[model samples]
Target: MTPMQLDLNLLAALDALLEEGSVAGAADRLHVTAPAMSRSLGRIRRSTGDQILVRTGRTMTPTPYAIAVRAQVHALLQQVQGVLAPSHELDLTTLERTFTLRWHDSLVALGGAALLAAVREQAPGVRLRFIAESSTDSPGLRRGEVDLEANANPPAAADVRAEKVAETAQVVVVRPGHRLAGEPAQPMTAEQYAAADHVAVSRRGNLSGTIDDALARLGLARRVVATAPSEATALEFVRDSDLVVTAPQATTRRASADLGLVVLPLPLDLPPASVYLSWHQRYDTDRAHAWLRELARTALDAPNRRA
Candidate 1:
């Protein structure tokens, strides 16, 4: 790899310029003179080998290159702030900032209530928003659109930081009084599970998944009659219908109240899956972020006993 040399000041200037899309606007945002901003922009253009922003008619337009690199610029800025502004301690009691987080609806049962309550109790000013589970989280986090991801089997990359937040097993769910609902005296058997029509949660519209794999290894299989984007939607589909839905215990717990469903341990045995909290490594030591991660761990693992 070619050795790289970059000035932190230049990166800051690039961040402002990319955000505002104009030298003058960047200068204003940075509280510097327009001429000074133009000079910094010139440096950026030379370093990047592209006119990061070009004047288009009455407005300054960011080139595709600028758009592509803006998120990196923002991340670099965040790192710089963390480094120079680092302290031995953090004051979250008075910290007021909105925190963006990504999670799926299924976790609502197990982690949601605790996560929200913990945030309120500790960092009262910190709020969260959920990202669609089916969407890729890296680009969104790197772009600063999402701060962290609550997910499973998170990507293992140099820039990614993931912490095991919870552990859960998938279980079969059906409405009360169904034929199979009361079929087993204990856990349902593999053959019995295979006979039920399942509603699958898949992003690619495929109707079968890991449950099939587990069953297949045991020489069994399930008949899938439906596919859905989320467990909530799947449970809703099977609410009053005769179809069965298998999902994370969290999902069954959350949807049970509204859907009036019963949770059954999957007849087939499988490893308990770990749910993780992930973020860019750049934020691993961030004070606010640290608080968020800590709270997430406590919230998610408290009831599950998976910490």
Candidate 2:
């Protein structure tokens, strides 16, 4: 058959076959007979000039070509469904959907409760899964594994949309009686701030960051006694010892307060940390997703407003 005569049903059948790796399993998924599914798979093989799935002993395995086109085929089917699906008014009261969010621990601590409360009140049937950030980069948004992300880092992918929802200034955190935390009227100088022992917050356990670079500009460098994998852990070190930690003001406010740590203005001039809300372009027009984004924007902005 020519390309013009290609059936959309064949695409569906191909997707199912590639995913299930067996005609019988594909038939069960598409609610068709195994014989019918085999026929459709034959047609797919002829159209693509490929034996998409080959029998490997008793089990079927996807060919290299089939594996290569699997994600593209699935994405195309989803796009077609979105385009052909009728636009209906969203009914949140009875909506049953779960959105997965991968966010920084700090952002979750700051805005998660508020976002959850808003979601529960607005759409009681909707659920949320707040996941931790990964150590390495991932295509979770593009793969639809993650529905939303809130963090300081912006996505670099062209298909991922990122919006800056909030910005928070950096502040130095130390124990209440620490020397740098001395006078309320007197501000700490760059030299004074850099003279103290410090604990860096680095996911990769690096001893330095932008703060170190800024200090080097002034020919000053603070000795980092330790590096913690997270801001929470770094703050714990600050609470117990003289190790100072520079952290974002808004997100760390509650935690610092709880730890009884003193927050001092950063002596060095630096741009505020930006909190970005990111999602895949495929969700741009999804009404439910759009609603969740708005709520998230509000929730993330709350801390900055209070700051």
Off by over 4 Å in 1: 1-10, 16-43, 46-49, 54-79, 183-187
TM-scores for candidates 1 onward, in order: 0.78, 0.84
| Top TM-score model | 2
50-118 per-residue lDDT for model 1 (tens digits): 999889898999999988988778977987787798476777788878777777656655677888888
Question: How many backbone clashes can be found in candidate 1?
Answer: 0
Q: Extract clashing residue pairs from model 2.
A: none
| RMSD vs true structure, all candidates | 4.8, 3.9
Q: Candidate 2 residues 206-232, lDDT tens each?
A: 888899899999999889989987889
- CA shift of 113, model 2, Å: 0.5
C-alpha root-mean-square deviation, candidate 1:
4.8
Q: lDDT per prediction?
A: 0.77, 0.91
For model 2, the run of ten residues with the poorest summed lDDT: 136-145
Clashes of each: 0, 0
